[model samples]
Target: MDADTPRRHDASPGQVPHDLLATAELVAGGALRSRDRMWRAGVALGRPLAYALPTTGAGSPPMAGAATLLLCFPFDLEEMPAGCGYRKIELAVTFDDESLRALDLQPGAGWAGPDGARVTAFGLGRNRLRWTFEAPRTGGTLSPDGRWAQAVLASPAPLTDVSGRVQVRGVIEHPLLSGTRAEGEVRTRDEVPFSLTRADVWAAAPLAGRTPRPGAWALTGHESIGPPGERLPPGRQHLCLAVDIEKYSTRGNADMIRLQRSLLRVMRAACARAAVDWDACGRQAQGDGYLLVLPPETDDTRAVPHLLDGLAGALAAVNREPHGGTRSPLRTRMRAAFHHGIVHEGDSGYAGSAVVELFRMLDADPLRALLADDQSTDLVVAFSDRTYQDLVPQGYEGLSPVGFKRTDIRVKQFAGVAWIRSHGHAGPPPPDLTAPV
Candidate 1:
């Protein structure tokens, strides 16, 4: 039979079968409990299949190891006139196999609905049961139609022979502005069901600097930034960045200073070439001896690429310089991190906070300090328009008129040479040292 077909059954009064009644009793008594084991089992069955099934659709298949028995009744919503009421309540029977089905057997013969409830029996092997109810005058709550398919699975064997019923309730709503909102609940036999309301999904459209290049690094996170009716300039926007830096050193304070200076020079030059406004930037010295900030940038697409190129040149120059040895480990680490999108972009305000937090965490870890010290100096560059606005200088705060539309580039390093060259030195240093050899 087609999965959508509804089954109908009318059990004689007082002659209702025990198994059928037991299933009803379990549901009525709210006996189906959610256990950690059950949840894990459901996950094991549903996770793999989640990819194949439509995440948001009525005809979508149910989670694995789940069986559904729904009964439908006809009711006029205009009569009840209560708040959005339910026209139907679908009863689900989730089990692993035929043996478990025996646990639900009723002594009597046929089946019947509870006074006003409607019933249906469509599946052949006791694997399917569907019911429909005519919603009361008040509208009925909408749920994921996929659950209908998920409710019909063989009972899973218990880990320790302990069994409980779990009610997984999900509400799905679609609004004109915000798109779709889906909320889920998991209720155990004993404890109250809790809603899983965390919003973890984020999405972003491709920006200008970065193209959807095949065989490039994995693109995972996505989020929508602007609200409907929010005015935005028309143009393709993309932001791509990489970071590299030298390692940090606890014992070598002098070496650390030298390395940090090199990193700072690279960052400053990159910002300048990118047309970023330094006066509007905010700087912070992390307790771990690293500096973090979000300098302002012109609202131009070319800013990110220029910053990246400048940073690369700065790293190469630092490596060849003769100040306190060739290169430092901290710089190398920063560079590697940048290449992999490890650093967060500081565009205006909170955008850069995540990166700063990560840096602070690394500073707090003793092992990280040692590794940063010994490893080659690396670079971390996050390109964006929103860095921490709080970090920006007050006078220049409103200078970034573009708001969230600007491009930002962030650079991080453990230690490197300073941006400014010491005076009284030779003329222009060596050509090979300064140039990208």
Candidate 2:
């Protein structure tokens, strides 16, 4: 706590209660004794960690005037979109069944304060705190590995009670974000924001900050968050992945049902592990295939390899379970295609070369033939030529040039190149590609 921050030392907050929010609310807006509602002076616990809720202790007068709740999101600074980057943050922090008014802007690194370009923060209702952090424009990029995009909510002096859980919803605008990640669009949990596609991204700990103890404040649920303050140009760009089950139509209905159920679970688990929120993606589910137009902040290099690894690990787990008639060794062997490019959403369907390219790699005869040749492999993936060049050669974890073989695509009117990697590949096989040099 800075000396400049306002503080009142005449009173003291109650003992650390089980439900801090409930107690804080009463103290914030409800009536409380002079002793229960005043800040204790002489406390200087400067800044709290990204994932902690510091409390005031017993003394002549407690010093932590306002309780600060910090939320550490899974966003990496480099994953920010190139389209005039900005982050939309909406948080629900209330006392007395109403919104918690703002006190001071958190001067933490990697955040834009109130003076940001065209900020509409203070004008919003008290039910939620809304802000858009202006970021680098086109041709510039933000810092790398700065994964903690946090919201510091400090209580006001008059009512020194800020506690309990705060629900947060945030998105770095990439045009596709507003339509996809709009609050309440999907009545389910949002995946922690990260592009499973980046190499530098670190997995979020179960809690944020160095000091994590039971009953600490948690940033868990997100209710209704507002749209971004500034709108960017609408774009169809996305890092996309296409998946299809092998011989899906030939399977009996019983097996088909099992596969379908397993596919959904597989995707959910993969997204959870990758820090790629399922809601951030534009999903188009086919009976035997699926297309995921991933969030814009996802990087192909990190997400591609990470998602591929997730698919392999998760599919292996599914196959190990007793499935497909009397404990079969495997029941869900599938093929996936990875690509990053434009993907269009319309009133009826999605149309774009990116979509076409993804499917071409997925359904191409050679990629299918490889899957058929290696029946023991649980999953096979094909990366677009450009996508492969961007990732595997960069020597990222879980990706290797020697493990991938270039495959020629001759599906329909679309013809291109794809690099294939099958599960349990021993090494690079002899070149069998039919594509030209």
Candidate 3:
């Protein structure tokens, strides 16, 4: 070959592994597809991650945060991708606010992150609009790495103050798995309360025969209400369980994402095996932690053992396999708190002294110290005196008080007694717990 022949770019410079680019292609046309099949086939990849954020934008009429609610899902293709918003959704929204008159919403989906992305206008009729967005494109919206593809709600039109709550049912279909319609899976849906003030965001309602203006709705905010849902009555007493990933903030976004997925699976699987009806429980997501308000009928006998044992078994199984991500394999370890008390639904979330006490136990100095000192342990639970007395002393089927040790908890304005238990060994309480209180 002539030396002057524009040698392949690979040979032109120091470029290495030039053929690596040969592998990039659209999987759509392939006869076999969807992430679900891969999951069923024993792939260790975690399930999809999604959540809803409700924000009130500032405008002539303060837009209802629900209108500016951002619907997020995930999509992967080449470096750049194109998609239609509604094709991948199968969700039903039930809200109690009667004054929520429909205002114009923006439609038309492209990438929803960065200056390079665009959210065009689309008229909404009967208010059934949500977009499963591009993850990488909208990294700026939710995730830093473009994991949550987002569809911002059209506009807010709350005639009165938010007097009721909104609930989302059904699942967000994975675009790649259009062939397999998985049902009743634990979908990622959370309420993000926003009090930001802006309007001129959502254009006019683009109902029938009307076209929504492109790039008209751009909802923005800084402060947000932590994600939580008070699905049960506050005065009602039930079992409360809360769990947090140890050292969650120390991990990168990718690791955090993987851990969150694993944690959910562990929770759901444990509940199922324990015969706990997860849906019946009032729940909330606390970034790195999760709280559950068990069903009123929950039998402490079965609930305690099942919840703890299931968590341990599931954690062992998942830890054996690497979760979804490019980082090193992540091992699941958490600190859990269990207490039985009356919980109330606050405007932002479930509030009450019970909620506060549960957190105090979970974050108790002894619990944190035990987890930190014992690296081999995967989980440590601090059961309030109420929980310990109800289960362990009553001779429940799976309850064993063998290694549990009494630990005094004094956090903030609360002072109480808690029993600490790790997988098989309960470490000594922190110095503070033993110090003069």
Top-scoring candidate (TM-score): 3
Off by over 4 Å in 2: 1-233, 425-437
Winning model by lDDT: 3
lDDT by residue for model 1 (248-323), tens: 5442544443444444455554555455643333333322233333333334334544554455555544554433
Candidate 3 Cα outliers beyond 4 Å, as residue runs: 1-71, 75-146, 151-234, 324-327, 424-437
Candidate 3 lDDT, 34-57, residue by residue in tens: 444322100111112211233433
Model 2 compared with the native: what TM-score? Answer: 0.44
Q: Deviation in angstroms for 178 in model 1?
A: 89
Candidate 1 global Cα RMSD: 27.2
Q: How do all the candidates rank in terms of TM-score, highest first?
A: 3, 2, 1
Ranking of models by lDDT: 3, 2, 1
Cα lDDT, all candidates: 0.28, 0.48, 0.50
For model 2, give the 10-residue run with minimal summed lDDT. Answer: 17-26
